[model samples]
Target: MTQPWKPDRGIRHAVIALGTCGVALVAAGAVLDSLWLLGLGTWCLIIAIGMELIYRP
Candidate 1:
Protein backbone atom coordinates (compact mmCIF):
# COMPACT_ATOMS: atom_id res chain seq x y z
CA MET A 1 0.00 0.00 0.00
CA THR A 2 0.98 3.58 -0.54
CA GLN A 3 0.87 6.19 2.19
CA PRO A 4 0.32 9.70 0.80
CA TRP A 5 1.28 12.24 -1.82
CA LYS A 6 2.72 15.04 0.23
CA PRO A 7 6.18 16.09 1.37
CA ASP A 8 7.44 14.41 4.52
CA ARG A 9 6.82 16.51 7.61
CA GLY A 10 9.99 18.45 8.33
CA ILE A 11 12.81 19.95 6.29
CA ARG A 12 11.39 19.37 2.81
CA HIS A 13 7.98 20.69 3.75
CA ALA A 14 9.49 23.74 5.37
CA VAL A 15 11.61 24.47 2.34
CA ILE A 16 8.63 24.08 0.00
CA ALA A 17 6.58 26.41 2.17
CA LEU A 18 9.37 28.92 2.05
CA GLY A 19 9.39 28.74 -1.73
CA THR A 20 5.66 29.33 -1.86
CA CYS A 21 5.94 32.31 0.46
CA GLY A 22 8.79 33.63 -1.65
CA VAL A 23 6.55 33.71 -4.69
CA ALA A 24 3.92 35.63 -2.78
CA LEU A 25 6.50 38.01 -1.38
CA VAL A 26 7.87 38.72 -4.82
CA ALA A 27 4.43 39.56 -6.13
CA ALA A 28 3.60 41.75 -3.15
CA GLY A 29 6.93 43.54 -3.40
CA ALA A 30 6.30 44.34 -7.04
CA VAL A 31 2.91 45.80 -6.29
CA LEU A 32 4.04 47.64 -3.16
CA ASP A 33 7.42 48.91 -4.40
CA SER A 34 9.33 47.25 -1.60
CA LEU A 35 12.95 46.39 -2.30
CA TRP A 36 13.47 44.65 1.02
CA LEU A 37 10.57 42.31 0.44
CA LEU A 38 11.90 41.45 -3.00
CA GLY A 39 15.34 40.70 -1.63
CA LEU A 40 13.96 38.54 1.15
CA GLY A 41 11.81 36.60 -1.27
CA THR A 42 14.76 36.07 -3.62
CA TRP A 43 16.81 34.76 -0.74
CA CYS A 44 14.05 32.44 0.38
CA LEU A 45 13.78 30.96 -3.09
CA ILE A 46 17.54 30.53 -3.32
CA ILE A 47 17.65 28.78 0.03
CA ALA A 48 14.84 26.51 -0.96
CA ILE A 49 16.64 25.48 -4.12
CA GLY A 50 19.88 24.87 -2.26
CA MET A 51 18.17 22.82 0.44
CA GLU A 52 16.35 20.70 -2.09
CA LEU A 53 19.63 19.94 -3.83
CA ILE A 54 21.26 18.86 -0.60
CA TYR A 55 18.38 17.04 1.12
CA ARG A 56 17.54 13.51 0.03
CA PRO A 57 15.21 10.96 1.49
Candidate 2:
Protein backbone atom coordinates (compact mmCIF):
# COMPACT_ATOMS: atom_id res chain seq x y z
CA MET A 1 0.00 0.00 0.00
CA THR A 2 1.06 3.55 -0.66
CA GLN A 3 0.19 6.81 1.03
CA PRO A 4 -1.56 9.52 -0.94
CA TRP A 5 0.23 12.75 -1.82
CA LYS A 6 -1.09 15.92 -0.20
CA PRO A 7 -0.73 19.65 -0.61
CA ASP A 8 1.61 21.45 1.82
CA ARG A 9 -0.62 23.30 4.25
CA GLY A 10 2.32 24.15 6.47
CA ILE A 11 4.08 26.15 3.77
CA ARG A 12 0.85 27.89 2.85
CA HIS A 13 0.23 28.90 6.42
CA ALA A 14 3.82 30.03 6.82
CA VAL A 15 3.58 32.27 3.77
CA ILE A 16 0.40 33.87 5.05
CA ALA A 17 1.86 34.41 8.48
CA LEU A 18 5.04 35.87 7.04
CA GLY A 19 3.07 38.32 4.88
CA THR A 20 0.97 39.50 7.81
CA CYS A 21 3.98 39.77 10.09
CA GLY A 22 5.95 41.68 7.48
CA VAL A 23 3.17 44.21 7.05
CA ALA A 24 2.78 44.64 10.79
CA LEU A 25 6.51 45.05 11.23
CA VAL A 26 6.65 47.72 8.57
CA ALA A 27 3.72 49.59 10.05
CA ALA A 28 5.24 49.42 13.53
CA GLY A 29 8.54 50.68 12.21
CA ALA A 30 6.83 53.74 10.73
CA VAL A 31 4.77 54.44 13.84
CA LEU A 32 7.48 53.76 16.41
CA ASP A 33 10.89 55.36 17.04
CA SER A 34 13.01 52.16 17.25
CA LEU A 35 14.61 50.28 14.35
CA TRP A 36 13.67 46.91 15.88
CA LEU A 37 10.48 46.67 13.87
CA LEU A 38 12.34 47.24 10.63
CA GLY A 39 14.81 44.60 11.62
CA LEU A 40 11.95 42.22 12.33
CA GLY A 41 10.55 42.89 8.87
CA THR A 42 13.89 42.01 7.34
CA TRP A 43 13.95 38.78 9.31
CA CYS A 44 10.44 37.93 8.19
CA LEU A 45 11.45 38.52 4.59
CA ILE A 46 14.36 36.17 5.01
CA ILE A 47 12.13 33.53 6.51
CA ALA A 48 9.73 33.96 3.59
CA ILE A 49 12.55 33.32 1.15
CA GLY A 50 13.57 30.24 3.03
CA MET A 51 10.04 28.92 3.07
CA GLU A 52 9.72 29.49 -0.66
CA LEU A 53 12.88 27.55 -1.30
CA ILE A 54 11.73 24.70 0.90
CA TYR A 55 8.29 24.52 -0.71
CA ARG A 56 9.50 24.68 -4.28
CA PRO A 57 9.73 21.37 -6.07
lDDT of 1 by residue, 1-57 (tens): 876764555877888898999999999999999999999999999988888777743
Q: Give the TM-score of candidate 1.
A: 0.77
Number of the top lDDT candidate? 1
Which residue pairs show backbone clashes in model 1? none
lDDT of 2: 0.81
lDDT of 2 at 46: 83
State the TM-score for model 2: 0.70
Q: Can you write out model 2's per-residue Cα lDDT over 1-57, one digit (the tens) per residue?
A: 855854776787888799789878978897896599988987897888788778865
Give lDDT for model 1. 0.86
